[model samples]
Target: MPPMVVLSFLDAPVVTGPARGLIHLARALPPEVRLHVAILRGRGAGPVPPLDEMSDGALTVHEIQERGPYDPSILARAVAIAWRTGARVVQSHSYKPHLIAMAVRAARRVPWVGHHHGWTAENDKVKRYHRIDAWSLPRADRVVAVAQSARDIVVHEGVRPDRVVVIPNAVDARDLSTPMTREEARAKLGIPEGEFVAAVVGRLSHEKGQDLALRALAQARAQGAQVTFALAGDGPDRAMLEALSRELDLGLAVRFLGHQKLVGVVYKACDMLVMPSRSEAMPNALLEAMTLGLPVVATRVGGVPEVADDGEMAWIVEPESVESLARAVVDCVARPEERARRVAQARSRAAERHDPARRAERYLDLYSALGVR
Candidate 1:
């Protein structure tokens, strides 16, 4: 069988949560299925040297150094690579890749699978991309959404419901389950002993609602909750969020650990994980924390309910509401027994739904259905 082409044309390097998820997927594929990864070149983006170390000769990385918006040369390079590799299936992971795949199908008639992680029209430029995705999606042989919420958005864009598949993001069950007590992790990270730590692990932005987390943390502290909020990712909104934290007088109560490469350690250090995203579609950070058996307080938005299962495995609160978020945080901190129960339930469900190898097997099945033997 020809190798499968997996396109990851991210604007930046593989530092973000989504990029890490893709790495996990690539490393998890069966050895018999050779994989070609096509990635855009940008800050932190380059030849993935670690794939050589990790994949046991099953993966190849291509760095496409195309640098302009709406550039057809990038698509040309992707098509040339696929044709040269005799790729039986071309799988795309974002709007750029999807558009490129659409063009490639016209040229080569190769089976195309478009993968949607999530969608956010945060501005006019993003709205344009959404339009582009809607325009090109019908050309794909299959469309994979990381969550049902994402699938619903695609279906609303007029694609046939059957064309879309929901594939929840997966986590490597090994690294997260490594034996590390919260105390040991906190010591390693220099967090004060006995301080309640709630971590928000994502890019600092309005859409991610890190600001909401800050407000909630402040409110919880005011109520004598004794909890500190740690933000584990950085973005353009970092300065703004820092300003808000100061305005709320959250001195020393908030820590900004920018771009955590060892995210599992961060999860282990925290007493609980909190996701205050105003919008989301199956956050991999939440999945990873849950798989590691961490208690969680997440906003009931997007696929969180699906992951949380109506509060069975997490304390779910309404999005963009600081009062509800504060309440959940305070309750989670005060009730250790309840948190432990939720953590156990979360681990069981995460193992059942988000195992990395199982996710790879599902993709293999999808590849077979696409007529790649």
Candidate 2:
């Protein structure tokens, strides 16, 4: 196959789940596969490190400044990059890039692959943006959904069933191969050694359900569970969630660590990971925690059940149910042997099913089917 160009948006200081997955996929691809990344960066955005620094110079990176959502110059610049690189296949992540890829395909006749990382309709503005995504997805040559449930949603939105594919996110165990011990990690984070730590790692937003996790934590503590909750990652909902935490009188029992750059350290310091998302599509945190042998108590939504079965690998609960979530946490903390058994199975499952190299091979197969040689 000729060189492939991946179009994405990355303006945050900390690497997001989709961006991290892209890096892992690029690194795991065979040495023969040439990948170029075209990043559409907003003005005054945070510093984006060179892709070559992360990929060991294996990827060619292009940064295009985006003026607004409907900037016509952005399309011209993107098409120019495709023509310059001779990209045979153009894969795009997120909504805006999907639109750009469609335009690029029209101008250059290149195959477009739209990657659907589930939508976050946190506000009216975002809901309107997602409608645009729904309108653009069916036009792509192929649509890649991170989970089966995500595929179902897009299909309902109008994408052809045969055109959509389910590819769960991948995790590299080697990234946390030599994690710090629990004692050392707790010391670094200033967490109490005697408390059982359950971490919720994601953006602080309504869709992420950090507030639900806070409510569950309060309920669990009321039931006499000695667990401390650690909330990681930063977003628009941080202030609201912090105020709710104080309202619950969760003093000294909850810690808000904003946008952890070294997330593996947070995983090491915690005894378990809680994914209380009201909505998700193959969360990278779940896979990372599984790879690290940390037991998980995740709400049964999106692609979570596809990754970890309830009572088999990780404890699964109903979404938007504080009582169910609290019960799961309390039960998980009460049963030490059960946590050990589940995490053992979870680690093995993560390594076998979610390996980045394996997922990259699947993408290659898809590329071949698209007449890229």
TM-score of each: 0.92, 0.95
Candidate 1, residues 1-373, lDDT tens digits: the string is: 4445544444335545455566677788865666777767643346543543444445677777766655667878877887787777777766777777777777778788887777775678888887888887866789988889989988888778988888888888654553677787777777888788888998877789998899999899889898898888988899999999999999889988888767777888888899999999889878988887778999988899988764579999989899999998999999989988888999999989888888888888888877877
Model 2 weakest 10-residue run by lDDT = 5-14
lDDT of each: 0.79, 0.86
- Give me the runs in candidate 2 sitting further than 4 Å from their true place: 1-14, 177-179
lDDT of 1 at 182: 72
Quote the positional error of residue 93 for candidate 1 in Å. Answer: 1.4
lDDT of each residue in 91-200, candidate 2, tens digit only: 88877787888888999897889988898778999898789889999999999899999999999999999999888899976555545788998888889878899999
Error of 1 at 27 (Å): 3.2
Model 2 pairs whose backbones collide: none
Model 1 residue 32 CA deviation (Å) reads 2.2
Clash count per candidate: 0, 0
Clashing pairs for predicted structure model 1, backbone only:
none
